[model samples]
Target: MDYIQMRQKRFLIAAWAFMECLLFGGLLYGWGSLMYVFKHEGIYAELCNNNDQAALSAMTNSSSSVTDVTLTNSSEETKLSDSNFKGCPEQDSKFTLCFTIASALVCASSAVLGQINFMFGTRVTRLISMIIFVGGSLMLAFVSKEIPWLIFPGLSLLAAGGLPLLVTNTQVSNLFGKGSSSIVGLLCGGFDMSSAVQMVVKIAYESGISRQHSYYFLTALHSLVLVSTFIFLPKDFILNEEAMSTNIEVAGDVNVTTELPIELKERGDVVNEKTGGLKENNYEKKELPTLMSCVRQPLYIMHVFWLCILQLRFYYIIGTLNPYLNRVLNKDDKMVSHFTNICFYIMMGGLMSSFLTGVVYDWQKRCFASSRSSLRQNLMPAVLPLTIVSFLAVLLSALVLVPVQSLLYLIFIILTLFRSFLYSMAAAFLSAMFPSEYFGLLYGIMILCGGVFGFVQFALFTWAETYVEAPRHTDIFLLCLVLVSFLHPLYQWYRCSRAEKELTQ
Candidate 1:
C-alpha cells in the first residue's frame, strides 16, 4: 500500500483493536461487580449453608448468654446469631480463590502467549485466544450452583484469552509516530476499562437479566474475535517505522525520510532533496542489543521491581474489595452495590488518564530531543512517568488506611490513575528500552513476575479476615512497599544525570 492508504488502514486497525480490547481484554478484573451476580446465583452458597448449620448447632450447645461468637475478632467476620446467621466466609473464600486464580492466569499466561505469538505469529496466538474466550463464555453461560467449579476454568480461560488482544495491540501504536506512546496508553486504558464489562453485567442482572443470558450475549460478542483475527489483524505483526522504512527502500520509494520526516528529524538526520540519497547529518545507527543483554541491565531489573511492588498493591485492593467495602459500609447491601458500580464507573475514566500518561512521555521526548546523541537523554523521558506512577501508588496505599467512608471516592480516583499508568508505562518502557523483536517475551516476563506477586493478596486477605485491624495494617505495610518503588525512578534520574555530566566533561 502507498503511504496515504497505509496511514488510513493503520488508523482503522488501531481503532478496531482498541474497541475489541475495551470489550474483552481485562473483563475478569471486573470481579468487584461480577461478584455480586455470583453471590446472587449462590455459586458456593452450599458451603455457607453448611457452615451456618454447624454454627447453629454450636450455638445451641453453648450458653444462651453468649450473644456472639468471636470469629477471629474482625469487623467483617461471620457472626453466630441466635435468630439468623447470614455471613458466608466459606462461600466468599471460594469466590476469592476463583478470582485469585483467574487474575493470576491473566498475568502468568502472558509469557507463554508472548512466546506463542513470537513463534507462531500473531494470527495463531489470537486464534488460540478466540477459542479460549468462547469456551470460557460458554462455561459461564451454563454455570449454576451445582456446577460452581465451572467458574474456576470459566474465569481463568476468559482472562487468559482476553489478554492476547491487549498484548498484540501494543504494536499497532507504532503507526501513530510521536503519539505512539499515547496510543499505547490508550490501549492499556482499553484493557483497564474492560473491567467495566462485568460492571455492565452486574447492572443488567439487577435489571432482572439472568447471568446465563448475559454470558450468552457475551459469548456471541466474543465471536467477533474470529473476524478480527482473519480480517483486521495481520498474520504476523504490524510494521514499525524501522521495518516500514526497510520495506519502502525495497519497494523503490526513494524518499524514505520524506515519508517519515518527523522521525528522521528526531534522530538528527537530514536527507538530500535533489539527489534523493546524498546527505546524512550527525546520525549513526548502532547495533541493537540482544534480548539477554537487555534483560540483564539494571534498568530492566528495577523496572520489574517497580512493576511487582505496585502490581501487588493494586491486586490486593482488588482481591479484598468486597470485604473491605462490606466492613466500611456496615454491610448495607444497597450502598455497597452502589459504590461497587461507582468504582467501575470511575475505572472507565482510565482511558483518559492512561492516554494523558502517554502524552506526558511523548512531551518529555520532545523536550529531550535536542540531545539526540546521548543515551542518557534517551532515558530521561521515561523517569517522569515512572515517578508519577510511584507517587500515585503511594497515595493510593495511604488513602486506603483512612476510615472515612467519603474518602472512598478519592481513593477510587487515585486507584484508577495508578492502575492506568502502571500497565501503560510497563508497555511503554519495554518498547522504548528494548528491541521490538523481543518485546513480546520481555513484556510477558515482566507481567509474569507481577502476576506471581499477585498471589500474595490471598495471604493478605486471610490476615484481614482473621484480625480486627488487619486491613488498615495491611495498607500501612503496602504503603511502605510503595515507598520503595520511588527508588526505581530515583536511580534512573541519577544514572541519567551522571551520564550527562560525564559527557559534558
Candidate 2:
C-alpha cells in the first residue's frame, strides 16, 4: 500500500499478470478483438484431438487427401481448426467443448490453490505463488506455439498467485483502518488496467506481427522484469521496512497504512524489539471464526451484503458494456477499434488507481484512528458521505450522455475514471471489515458473491436487453447507483444494530 516502498513487488505482480494475459488474453479473452488473424491464417485454430483416428475423421470430413501426422498420447491429435466457423464465437464450435473441458480442469487447480492459501501465512504463500507465477510466464514464453501446453502453466500459476493478491489486501485492511477501500480498489483497478494495457499491445501487434510471434514476444518481455524483482527484493522478510510495519500516515485524518499479520500457527513470528529481528514463537492453534459464525455476526453480515450487491452490479454493467457498444453504437471496424482503445484506457486508469487506493486507504486510517473501536460511528461517518457523493455523481454524470453521442463519449471517459476510483473502494473497504486472519478467505468470499451475482445479472440483463437497448443501458446503471447511495446508511445502520444485538445476546 505504501507505493514508494512496495512498488517493486507491485510492479512484478503487474508485469507477471501482463504476460499471462498477453498469451491467453489474445487467444480467449481478446479473441474477438483479434479476429483478423484467426480468419486468415488458421494457425493454432485447428482442432486435432490427440487420437490419430479423431484427426483423420475430422480431416476426412473436409478432405480425402490425408495429411500424415504423428499421434502422441491423449494430447497427440487434438487440435483446433483454423476455419472461422459459426459455432465458435471466436474460434470454432469444437473449441467450445475443448475450452470448457480444459478450463474446468484448470479451474479445479485454482480451487485447490484457493483453499491452500487459507492454511499458510500470507507472506509464505505469496513467496510460493510468485515462484509459480514466474514459472507460468516462462512456460508461456516457451510454449506459445503449443497452445494446450500453455494452459497448464497459465492456470496453474494463476491459481497459485490469485489468493496471495487478495490476502495482501485483506492484511492491508486489517492493518490500516480507514482507507482500506482505496487500497483494495487500487489492486482491482491495476488488474483491469493491466488487462487494458495488454489489449493495447494485442491490438497494436495484430496490426503487424504474427499472433504466435506476438504472444512469445510479450511473454519474454514481461519475464525480463522477474530478474530485477529477485535481485532487489530483500533476502530476509523482517529486514523489509514496509513489510514489517503496522502503521503509516499519508495525509491529515484521511488515510492510514499498516501491515496486517497472520501466523500459520497459533504463535508464528514475533519481532524482537532489541534485536530488530523476528523470533519464532510457534504455539498451538486456537479455533478461528467460521463463515457461518462470521455471517451470524452483524458487522460481517452487513459488510458482505453491500459488497455482494455493489460488486455484482459493477461486474454486470461492465460485462454488458462491450457487446452493447458494438451492437448499438454502430458495429463498424472503426467503432470496434474505438471500443478496444477504451478498454486499454479504462485499464490504464485502473492500474493507476491500484497505487492510489493503497495511498487513500492509508490516509483514511490516519483520519479514523480516534474512533477505531466503534464500528459504525467511527468508520461509517467518514466513508459514508464520500461513498454517497461519489455514487450519485457517477450516476448523474455517466448517464447524461447516454441519449447523445458526443456527450456519451465524454461520459464514458469520466465514467472510466470514477469506476477506477470507486471500485478500488469496494475492494479495500471489504478487506477492512475483517481481522487479518480472514483476509484471503474474506476477499475470496467477496469475489465469489460478485461472481454469483455477475452470472445472474448477465443472464437477466441479456434477457431484458433483447428489448432494451444504449440510453436504457446508461439509465439502468445510473438508477442503480443513485438507489444504492441513497439507501446505504439505513441498510448499514440496520446491519450494525443487528450485529450489536447478536453480540449482547
Candidate 3:
C-alpha cells in the first residue's frame, strides 16, 4: 500500500488500458460484422462453388424457369422464407450447421489454448499470437477461388488470434491495480469507440472501393494495434518481467485507500490474520472457480448469460447492419456512404456518454458494498437498470422502425445509439462480477455464445427478409421489442436473487 506499489499498479493498469484500445481492431469487430454473411455466403458458395450470382439470383427470384420449377407455388412467402431449401433443399441447413459447429469448435479450442497461453505467461504468448494473427488475416486478402478452403486455415488463424482478446483484460489487471475503475472503463469504452471508428473508416474506404477490398483497410489499422501493444505495454507488464519489485505509490494528490475504511472493515479476524500474501499474485482469487462452481452461482451465471444475450443482440444488430440499413433506408447507396454517417455518429456519441457512466456506477457499488468481509464480491445489481432501459429502448426503437421521413430516420439513428449505450452497460456489469483472471475466459465464452447467437440471428433475419417482401420494419422492431421485454425481467430476477444471496453469504 506504499507509494511505489501504487505507482506500479497505475503503470500496470495503463498497460491493460493500452491493450484494450485494440478493441475490435484485432479480434472482434470484423468477425462481429461479418458473422451472418460468413455463414450465409459461405454456405451458398460451398454449394454452388464459383457460381455465386446464378445460385443467389435463382434462390432470390419470386419464380424460376421450367428446370427450376421443382416446387409448386402454393405456400406463403413466410413459409418459403422459413424454408429456403425447396429449390435446392439440400444446401440449406448445411451452412447453418457448419457455421455454428465450426465457431463452437473454435471457441472450445480458444478456451483450451488460453490455459496453455497462461502457463507461458501473457506477454510472450500474446505477442506471438499477434504475429500468427497477422499472418492469418493477411492470407484473407488473396482468397479468390476455393472460399471453402479458406474457411479452414483462415478460421484457425482467426480463432487463435481471437483467444488473446479474452486474456487482455487479465493482463491489464496485472498491469494496473484495481484501485481505480478508470482503467476498466477505458478498456470497455475503447471497444465501443473502436467499433464506431471502424464503421467510419470502413465507410470512408468504400468510396470507390470494391466490397472484397474492404478488409484490406483493416489490416493497416490492426498493424497499428500491434505497434501500440508493444509501446503501451510496460516492460514490467509481466508479473515476472521485472527483476526489481515495484512497491505501491499514489499517482496524484488525491487520497486513495489501500485498505478498507475502519467502519466498513470485516468485524471478525480470521486464521489468516498473520498470513502473507503471495508476491507474484497481483489479481484477486475466486474461492473455488471451477467452471461448474462458477456456473452454479446463479448470479454469476446470470451475469455471464445476460452479458452473452445482450452481446448477442448487440452483435446481431451490428452484423446485420448492411441489410438493416438497406431495409430501413436507401438501397442505392452503399453503407459507407454519407447516408449512414448519422448512424455512426449516433453510435459514437451514445457510447462516449455510456463510458462516463462507469465511474458513477462503480462508486454506487462501493457504497452498497461498504462491508469489507468480502471485499471482492460482485456488484452486478448496478447493471439491472441498464438492462431494463436498454430492453425498453429496443422496444421503443422497434416500434418506430419504419421511419417515414428524414426526421423519423434521424430518430431511429439516435434510438439505435441509445440501444447500444444501454446494452453496453452490461460489460461493466460483467467486469464487476468477475475479476481479471476470469474476465478473459468469460469474455471468450460470452463471445463464443454470441457467435452462435449471430448465426441464429442471421437465420431469423433471412426468414424475415424473405417473408416481409415489401418491408415490415414495424414488425421486425416489435419482434425485437417483445424478445427484449421478456428477457429483461428474467435478468432482473436473476441479478436481484444473486445480490441477495451474496449478501446472505
**Which is the leading candidate under TM-score?**
1
C-alpha RMSD (angstroms) for model 1: 6.6
Candidate 3 ranges with C-alpha deviation above 4 Å: 1-113, 143-163, 170-180, 196-273, 276-291, 334-336, 371-381, 384-389, 396-400, 403-427, 469-505
Best by lDDT: 1
Is 1 or 2 the stronger prediction by lDDT?
Answer: 1
What stretches of model 1 exceed 4 Å from their correct place? Answer: 1-4, 50-87, 247-288
For candidate 1, give the lDDT of residue 231. 76
From the highest lDDT down, the ranking of the candidates is 1, 3, 2
lDDT of 2 by residue, 281-380 (tens): 5442223446555545544454555555554444444434444454555534345457656645554555564556557656666655553234533345
Writing each residue's lDDT as its tens digit, candidate 1 over 1-505 gives 3345546798787788889999999888798887777775656666775576565565566444445555555554554542223237777778788888887887888889999988988889998888989898888888886777998999988899898999887888877887888889989999989999999999998898988889989988887777668776678877667545544433443445322221232343455443333255544333344567667778788999999999888888887788778888976566778899989999999999989889999999998877634555567899999999999998888888886799999989998999999999999988776666677889988888888888887887777767688778888888998899999999988877876676578
Worst lDDT run of 10 residues, candidate 2, spans 257-266
Which candidate, 1 or 3, has the higher TM-score?
1
What tens digits encode model 3's per-residue C-alpha lDDT throughout 1-505? 3334535565654554544454432333333233233332333434533344444454576343223223336841121221122222223333333334444545555555455554455556567666656665666554443554554455456546645643454345334434334444555455445445445444443344432465566455456545435554433233311111222333434332222211122222222111211212353221324544444555555555554455444444444444455445533233323444555556455445544555556565666565333433333336545655456555544644554435544654545444434434545554555433444455556555555554554454445445544235434643464465345446654644654567677
Query: Per-candidate TM vs. native?
Result: 0.86, 0.58, 0.63
Q: What is the lDDT of residue 346 in candidate 3?
A: 60
